[model samples]
Target chain A: MMDKIIRDNYQRETKIIDAVYPRTYRDSTIVHSDRLQCVYDVFTYTGDRLNDEGVKMNLMFLHGSGMNRFIWDYYVAHLLDYKLGAAINKIVTLDQVTHGDSSVLNRGKLGVGYDWSDGARDACKVAQKEFYSGLEDNSDDIINIVVGHSMGGFQAMCCGVLLPSLFDFIVTIEPVAYSPNVPNNSNVTVLPPKFFKAIASKVEDEFKNEAEYDKFMHERSFFTKTHPEIFERFKETERINMEDGSIRTKMERRQEMLCYMTLHPTSYWLLDGAKHIKVPVVSLVGGIATWAPKENQQVLQKSIPNYTVDVVPQGDHLMNIEMPDEMLKRLSVHFTKFAKEYQSKNYDNSNKSVARREEIFEEIYKETERNRVKNGKPVLAKL
Target chain B: MMDKIIRDNYQRETKIIDAVYPRTYRDSTIVHSDRLQCVYDVFTYTGDRLNDEGVKMNLMFLHGSGMNRFIWDYYVAHLLDYKLGAAINKIVTLDQVTHGDSSVLNRGKLGVGYDWSDGARDACKVAQKEFYSGLEDNSDDIINIVVGHSMGGFQAMCCGVLLPSLFDFIVTIEPVAYSPNVPNNSNVTVLPPKFFKAIASKVEDEFKNEAEYDKFMHERSFFTKTHPEIFERFKETERINMEDGSIRTKMERRQEMLCYMTLHPTSYWLLDGAKHIKVPVVSLVGGIATWAPKENQQVLQKSIPNYTVDVVPQGDHLMNIEMPDEMLKRLSVHFTKFAKEYQSKNYDNSNKSVARREEIFEEIYKETERNRVKNGKPVLAKL
Candidate 1:
């Protein structure tokens, strides 16, 4: 029924975009730029592209760690069938380099570890090529919104910062962003990255068969509350068949562990980089305190100038999978409100004035240069 | 002249105490505990131990990075000669491993990289053995005070947290502690750890002769304002005579680089560990902005419960060497005030009440455990 609804409401196309695997830190000029094909799904609306409000939103969905683009299958279907007051021209979903179909394509070409900024770089490229290729800046009626969960949620915010002009709005659900500045207000303290890495090291790599994998996942509490339909999609897309007919999870355990390890530094970078995001950001956090405390969401609200955090009742980290309807309701309300605001506000005010993000970036770059000491000599000597 | 004053006013003894080289992270129980000899110097006052105000104080001075206990020579001489309205029973100073004479003694036995908490552990063991050993809890008449500069300053705060009962006060001088929570009010943004590591890697490790080393150092602006006598002491004691008649800095360049790399994590750890410190902390910052920003000192002021930041006029990062008189005057005033306050306040109130630090530590430990997921199974499963 869900597949039929999705098939009838939208025209789906599997597309691949060129992406670069960055080598240097902070996306510095020194990059290998290993050309890889990043696979994504695009769903174009068959009905009226513009809603009653006469506004169109083009959204790109990004999955979290160890998950694939198909995790959004249920949510996308609901959005396409029930526009929920906001019109959608198209919806896009991505599979990260080492997850799902992208994992198979970039099997041996993957980098040693994940540089989170690389994800932002790839997403920016995709958004530019897919949505803004021939459109004039500020002329395109389509509002570009990037919605992501967990790790992808962090990347969505990064996308806004890396290219502030690209994204119009960003929605992150339970982003694994931790800031040292904020106190953990949950009942328990969040464990450090090392502990998560240790747990990742021990994740089940392979199963005898799909049924066995299903049984194993069902036993784990992390996926117990996942909607049955979403669970089926996750089980099908999150793993691949082995040569011997067994199955293995798409994301390598080592890669997952590496992702967990990079969480701290990358999260801190996001906290520092968030101030540059000139777009509105709304974070949908789980009301139920789980791995990520509710206060963790405040990191974005505190740093970003225009940011809000909404708590989904009885929702957990996997709220998108567990209660897609609740997430959809909040998304529709937020996108409608944001679309009206964007129409009323002078969106071109920033472009006419100084590009504050670029200015701040330049300021930070110069400041870093001035503070550096080279060869036992200070460039601008002080004390 | 300084040597004559120091020799006449105090009875000095070189002491060696046992210390452990921690191997595990966070000084976890899984440690090698490689036994090592930590060396220190004791300067017992020859005059009346108690001040006119009827208070006795025992002082321990810890040197900053790339420095030894001898860095305190001028400061110690001044303190011994002029009591500064306060009396001192004895003054002690330490040479951290890989920095001074201890570097030569512990040659080839040092651990790879630095675990900052190990410094606190060593200092705690030394404090308990030297000052508090055989003394009944809350019965010791001498108020123990620890004064550390830069890296040692950070360690002094750690010392207070690790064993709060040992030290009555902690004074940190332009400590290398940086917290992301504080807005760096200085004109420039401080360079990250990687930049410092690069600088450390390029430092001149070996000098042809003492005169060449002196000439090289004098050419750099970093040491231009250093007091001539203190600069002489620094040049003489900071380096060691090599086997080929050349001179090499006591601390290895690679070790120093590792120390720089560990600064970020260790500083964050200090921010978290600082709340546990029940004693008063005074951070002496340089009025002249140099490598360490004045706002960087505010990290301690914000996190620590009973902490204060004092700016020393015309002083920089190496204020202890550049303006020892200014540092000494502030120390005398702060210490004198602290001593009098300690005498008036109920010093044993915390001991009689709940041990808050231990309770917090246990709470964090249990929280970590509850939040940890082992073998794909959360101990206290949620979501």
Candidate 2:
């Protein structure tokens, strides 16, 4: 049934947006020249959509590091199955800056040391533009949910904290929400910045062809268990062709290394920012810990009062990629349950949600006004 | 001559400032309650002071972690010698937040994960209030020089970047301006967060009396070569006399650990922020590498075009604490050379410096006005 849905109607519109956020150092030194060009794909439901009374969801999917928006194509196709399709509105998945098409746009401007919060802000900007643009509120009717994997999972968590009123529910698959305070697995020695550089420097950048790249990836343990079709999808989405008929990874190795260095600050932010998250979050951890330890996962569960931890017995850090079927099953069950519960539950803050939306919109309008005034541009309205 | 000056003429007045800057996480989540209470001592020249024709100067001293402003007392006392005292007007030594008196004042409000940039800002606020407050510019007459050790040294470099027109020169003693891109000592494995926490947790926080601390510190290699008088000063400034007759360190173990975790970001910031620093910076590194590798020190020299590195033989990371005489000698020579050069050399941007000062003041005023408006206070000025 899922295959038929994907084959028949998996149409998507690609979005290219100029994200005006300037890159900044840890000391808040804003680099105005470094801008992120965000690229996302919106998969709108072509079939009969849900009515006004039914639960309508604008699902935002964020891919992990070294991945692009197209990674979610297979998963989005599965979401379109009749079991979850009735409530589907649109599925939006984005390529993080320095990944996929966005990397091509931000090539020379990419700065050293990526901050996960910036990634969160990037995601929020796109989400706000897509779902909450106007002054009129649409909170009680349409729900916005974020589904992310690995690094993206952590960004999803950040989204919940940055704008508490934006997201309805968050699903994180093996998120890197580690805290140094917690006791981690003894066997796994965390990589230092030096090691990160070494690893990135050693990565093979150029390949002869797609077939050659496939052969190389097949040898790696992480890719061995990945679904063959998904592996093919990765080859398509994760690499770009050169003029000389060679191919290279869309995400630069330097950018990937910066992402690794960013893991430290991300852990710190997660520990401190966890207390501010008011939305319900469901984290899927693997039985065998890979990057974030099992103990850290437990701490993460305890950190957020509304967070739940679900351990997949045979899965590891790359569970979503390696065991897509298992992840899809869990996701389907969760969506169905959440959708049903969401519709029946008495939300006392339904009115507050509308008011909060207006407040957010007003805040955005005021900021725009400030920028307009700063640039000496003509102002449309007074703040 | 140094001994005569120390015994007869050294006098200092202590000042406590309420640093209005709030504690913020890497994600920019500002914790307003966690404010820094800065404590500094202003040492006035009781002897014949330098006139406006001569080089009038304000030298600011900053100590390292597990230390206080008093660590510079011995060094400050020496600076009043006839060789350097003729040109010296005043010396100000400050205790960083979470150290000495400042730590006692900030006991309950210290947040986890310290950012070195905040430390720099704290120093800047104090320097600005003490030296650069009035609308009239004093850039030409009273040259501001910052002398910092270890963590404080890095913050000194940061001050140069934050307000380019504030300081004329910076002297850093074994600053932790490390970069992962540089080749570091292979023997030193960068301590992971778990190790930092473990180390902090294992630190001796309580002692029976001053004698016990002396005995404990005497056995440590870093303190073995420290002057006995300075060692006594350490006991006086580094620990707090508790109500229960027990002595505890002023800087909390948790805060110390946060300081360690911050080294990573400090390294990243120094690498990025070095280029923006227009002032001449002299970094006095130890011959034996301690926390930061010699290679990283060299990289620091390379990163800042005007930066110079001087290695002190027989000195380690605690060179300033262990061998104050050597550091003082270098400082005196540099100050004498700079003072003479500054008087003769024509600065074409003397007018620009005044303009820059006004620009900074206006920025501060606008920010304060915005905050006042946010808090519903009466507006005092226009942008």
Candidate 3:
């Protein structure tokens, strides 16, 4: 059902860009010292323009461990239509150094250790060189927003800290920015080794048959409660059949583990950088008591003084998919407010014309109204 | 940071129960009926267990039009942990009628007007009944909670209204339960229809190719922005290759319209039913300012006199997934308070041996400590 909705509601174009270096190794020299070569996949809405500017918010999504940028596809669709017939900006998703279609590290070697900071640096390099380049050219006219979820959220924070001048705003959903030496006594931890071993064994057994692995992961992963249409759609895109009729995740498992093991200690770089960030920062925390400890929120609020945290009620780690509407709402408010403030501050008294601004607003209103009628909701229309 | 942590710590178990029906509709009998059938799929941590005598929360996930139950897998995984760790009673998920493995209405006939109330009725008969039966059998020992998102959320409200006795609590994330009728004289009505057609046409063009269609939906759907992981997963599960080499959604498109257009009018059956509900209700409204009109929340709160409406700051319709941890926190506070009150009233006076209860508490404490250690955190040598 969701597929048809997407078909009936959204249009996207995905293009894979080749990275300069095909692989990253612990000892490998940087191919481009100033930039990291990586694949950029942009999902643009070929629908009616939501704004008079015909501009969209460009999100450079960063994937979590063992995953790729593809994780965000589901959420982007629902956001296409705002509750009041408002449309959101476009999204550009990318794979981190060793995940997804991007170049593998150590020539595809499994479990090679990589510095967590380097990954952040690489992400910033991508944003500045690839994502921001376009935005920079249109900085005066575009309303750009940066959105990241989970690890992607972390990367987004890194980007905000590193390139604060480039983005109009930053939004992180359940960002994992744990500081080292923080008290862990009351924190939730992983189960025993035996439990993990059991899980590993099960995974291995399933790996012997790709389809079984797919089924196993499908059932076991945190997606069991998802709507079936979504679940089925995800399974189709995320699972790849192996030669033996078993399905293996497109992402390598060991690399996934490496990403998991790597952690960024509360770095002075991020902390110092965040202090200087000029744009509004909205952090969304899921209320899954287990995933996010109360202390974490306290620590974050304390660490990033300028940050505004919104705790999503009844949300978990995967809050974006579980609650896209909520996430978007928060984002919309922040973006709208930011855009308004930005325009006000940057407005030039001599160059600005009240009549011109009103004219523009009128045009946008007409366009929005037209969209509502064509979409079949002539009632409750927004302009 | 969360991505790495999840990679290191996350493990899940998924199960699918077949032959679940959301609701049944007999064209000759009634325009909208109150029974639905659905498959009940559950996901949980392998070692996690719920409190033996607490209220259990059942999440009845309803997919949007053309979607199935798979969209909620991620939510289930996260909510399952709540049920296990927080002493939640149980979690139940099902495919809506005409979707997933459930029997389709009209045997794949198109353009069936599936009233939203009918969908709600289906939930009442199938999922809600089973949940009530479980709670009723354990009424002296357990409580019941309901969580729903998007269309599923609307069904949750219907269930709350129709079967007020079944749930002790209800949470709806960005539920489009009612949209105020716009005045015809409003300027919004004057917009050109071509604009709406353009938006609709763009959506239609997404289905030109199978892979593109899948990608289009995966990228634009609500899940895309919030729960990217599950979004990817759903895209994989619910798409089929078409004869024209385009991917056709496995779900019937007309069913999607039915889910939206078939909403039950806020009639006496529903409005009066709300007045009779005995449990606390929490409606998590997304503050996107676009999707959910302020009037909708007002109407819901007015209808359910005992309800508590919380506006998720900067949240969209799918607030649950967008900010899972935050949502969890809000829900936990409510549930925990309810649980504590219930326990104090009912179990406080029971003359169970203090020594026995103490021993049980100690055992639980020890288990929790063990779990902390297993998760790779430093543990005090002596608890």
| CAPRI quality of model 2 | incorrect
- Candidate 2: pairs in clash: none
Candidate 1 ranges beyond 4 A from true positions: A25-34, A81-85, A134-138, A179-194, A346-383, B1-383
Q: Provide the lDDT at A354 for model 2.
A: 40
Q: Considering every candidate listed, which one attains the maximal lDDT?
A: 1
Interface RMSD after interface superposition, each candidate: 24.7, 27.9, 24.8
The digit string of per-residue lDDT tens for model 3 on A243-355 reads 76766555555345434334322233344334444467788888773454565456556756468988788878776766666766776676666666656654222222446
Task: Judging by DockQ, tell me the better candidate of 2 and 3.
Answer: 3
lDDT of 2 by residue, B318-340 (tens): 88978888888888888776666
Q: TM per model?
A: 0.45, 0.46, 0.41
Looking at candidate 1, what is the lDDT of residue B198? 48
lDDT of each: 0.66, 0.65, 0.50
Evaluated with TM-score, which candidate comes out highest? 2
Q: Find the 10 residues in a row with the least total lDDT in model 3 chain B.
A: B25-34
DockQ of each: 0.02, 0.01, 0.06
Lowest summed lDDT window (length 10), candidate 2 chain A: A374-383
For model 2, state the Cα shift of residue A274 in Å: 0.1
Q: Which lDDT tens digits does candidate 1 get at residues B38-127?
A: 788888778554577655677888887667788798887887644544577678888876567776676544544455556666676666
